[model samples]
Target: MRETLGAEDPSLEVTDLDAATAAPGDLSTLASPSLFGEPRLIRVGGVERLSEAFLNEALRYVESPADGATVVLRHAGGVRGKKLLDAVRGGAGGGIEVPCAEVKRDADRSAFASGEFRAAGRRVAPGALRVLVSAFQGDLAELASACQQLIADTTGDIRESTVQTYYAGRMETDAFAVADAALAGRAGEALVLLRHAIDSGADPVPIVAALAMKLRSMAKVLDAKGPAARIASEHGMAPWQIDRARRDAQGWETAGIGRAIVFAAETDERVKGAARDPEYAVERLVRFIAARGGAG
Candidate 1:
């Protein structure tokens, strides 16, 4: 938003104030019409922990906002200043609220990354988006930063290889890579990656969790029919997931996918605590899946 505002007017002045330490009349002074009358943006953060003076002043300022100034009050969702929130939300200031909810779900994060590319007038392959999302997982800020970096540093349509080139050796991507190798019957490479991941301080829990997630996806697409996109929607999966699972399902029987799922569950338990040698248990799980749930 700040970038957009700046792009529109290079002379746009921005003032950042902390509601927690703001003195009385600070807002009014900045918000009041300047002699030069340049466009200004007043950003007040920590509104959720606003001081009494700020709260009182803000309530009044909202009623009669300054011209040529955009006063943005950022409250991170709390009841600290209910009166101000109510007044602003009740249309007293004719302001629109932009909600910044936490992005916790995989689908939401995928959508976020896609939106970032779309906003930049760029395109990312679904596989690239998938791996990028898995690579960042829980850190939306990091994901957004990664997207921005890619947009700024690279050119052309983003592909899976692009993401892998940028973030191949990360722990998260390594986990998924190990799973992919194992499920595709590349046991030797999978085991090597698995040990390397562990040596790099990657926890066995997430490694096993990654394997289990793939196993579940494989199982879900076992008997699925129709177009990949339609089947993916029915099974709550991405089209890429369905396509990848189908490719991994080749040369494997129904019983094999089922057995792999069971072994994944067992390995998940062992890695959590059931087995003293969790590393060994995961190796066995990899070998089992690599054999397509048959004798190695």
Candidate 2:
């Protein structure tokens, strides 16, 4: 939003103030035009914690906004600034509310990543986007930063290999590596990677979660019929994911996959504090899956 305003007004003078710390006359002083008369943008944060004086001034200012100045009051949801919020919503100051909600779901996060690339006029392959999403699942800010770095540092279309090149050492990537090694029946390699991940301060929970995701993907595609793309759409998975899971299931029996899935769930619980030794629990899971060649 600030970017849009800056693009529209080249000389936009941006001022940031915390409503909790703002003084009595701070709003009036900034709202008033300068001698040069450049358009001003006043972004006031933490309005939910606004001082009494700031609240009174904001209520009045919103009713009759200053010319050549746009004041944005950011209030995280609360009743602390109900009067000011109500006045603004009732059409005082011609103010409009813009809600910045939390992004939690994988699909939502993926869409956000896609938007970041689209906004930069860049093209990212679906497989690359999946890798990027998986590599930074829990941190939206980091995901956005990774997308931007990819946009700025590289040229042309982004690929799966490109994401791997940049984020191979990331914890999530490492977790997936552990999963891949275990699924490929390489118990020793998976154990080494698992120990390294834990020693690197990787959380056991996400590691187990990564294992669960990989195991569940295989289960979903186990008996799935039709084209990869069609099945992927039906299951809310990427085609690449469907193809990879199918390949990973080549040497596995149905009963083995089921057992692994159940074990993955138990490991997930253990890592989330259900057991006394989470790391030991994770090692057990890695060896178990590898022993069965990731069958279930």
Candidate 3:
């Protein structure tokens, strides 16, 4: 549907629901166009947050959407927003629900990389694809950005070396790399990358945010208190991923995790200008976390 729409349309109205509210008037304007003419496409984004009233109205319109009008809804996949999803599925109409799950595995990352290459009207070698997947890991937005950067930075075809060169300094910009290194007990390497990140002008807040996310994931594994196999099965994660998280969690007691959370909060305050030398603050945080991990 998107392919056809992209090929046939010259104009598209893509709205981000996170940035826009959908009211009855808005839907009315969408359903009934101006006296001037018709739009080629009308997309309603962030559909997960649409109000119940707006959703019902939009569903009604979907039953008989205007000619040449295409309605695209972007949902980040939430079961709590299932009411409208059920309505769309049960309705006698064509609809698509793009599930944007977080990528975590090598196979999933390869699929995404290939899809991006295809989207850009290009081809990637198998070895090059593997390199791209490893370099970008599992973040869709980052992968997409890297694809755009590569497309602009190179011509003809993208190769493994191209990916390697483009990603030479990616570790400094990628907060996940820092978290992964730290979680794997590579404190010295993580500290070096953390320092490089600060020197390369990466903001401290996002680094802290990424670290908090890693800590929270570890805490989830710890608090699950279930067998690693059971937790992996229940969470749809690989046993290795679960086991690695378990080991990482062992390096921090509950009290230690609590203190890290507090430290993150203070670092956040400092980054927001409540304190001076945000870089030094984050450096101290990294050392403190490494010390805690070493103690464990």
What's the TM-score of every candidate structure?
0.71, 0.69, 0.47
What's the true lDDT of residue 230 in model 1?
94
Residue-wise lDDT of candidate 2 within 118-183, one digit each (tens)? 877799997788778889976455686799789989999999899989997787887888988998
Give the per-residue lDDT digits (tens) of candidate 3, residues 1-296: 44566666545443222213676656646646546554545555556566776777776776776765566665555664576677667753576556566677555666766777787688777646645654565345557567767876788778867776778565433565676666666779878988877777777877777777557657668778777768766765545556666777876687777777677777778878977788787776676666653332
Report every candidate's CA lDDT.
0.85, 0.84, 0.65
What C-alpha lDDT, on a 0 to 100 scale, does residue 187 get in candidate 1? 92
Candidate numbers sorted by TM-score from highest down: 1, 2, 3
lDDT, candidate 1, 1-296, per-residue tens: 65687788877887878898999999999988777887889888788889999999999998899888888887866789889988987988797777888777666788889999998789999889989998998546568778978998899999989998998766788899898899899999999999999998888887888888887777778787889989877876667778888887888788988888888898889999999999999899999989999866
Higher-lDDT candidate of 1 and 2: 1
Highest TM-score: which candidate? Answer: 1
Backbone clashes in model 2, listed as residue pairs = 256-295, 256-296, 257-295, 257-296, 258-296, 260-296
Cα RMSD to the true fold for all candidates? 5.4, 5.3, 9.4
Prediction-by-prediction clash tally: 0, 6, 0
Which residue pairs in candidate 3 have backbone atoms (N, alpha carbon, C) closer than 3 angstroms, thus clashing? none
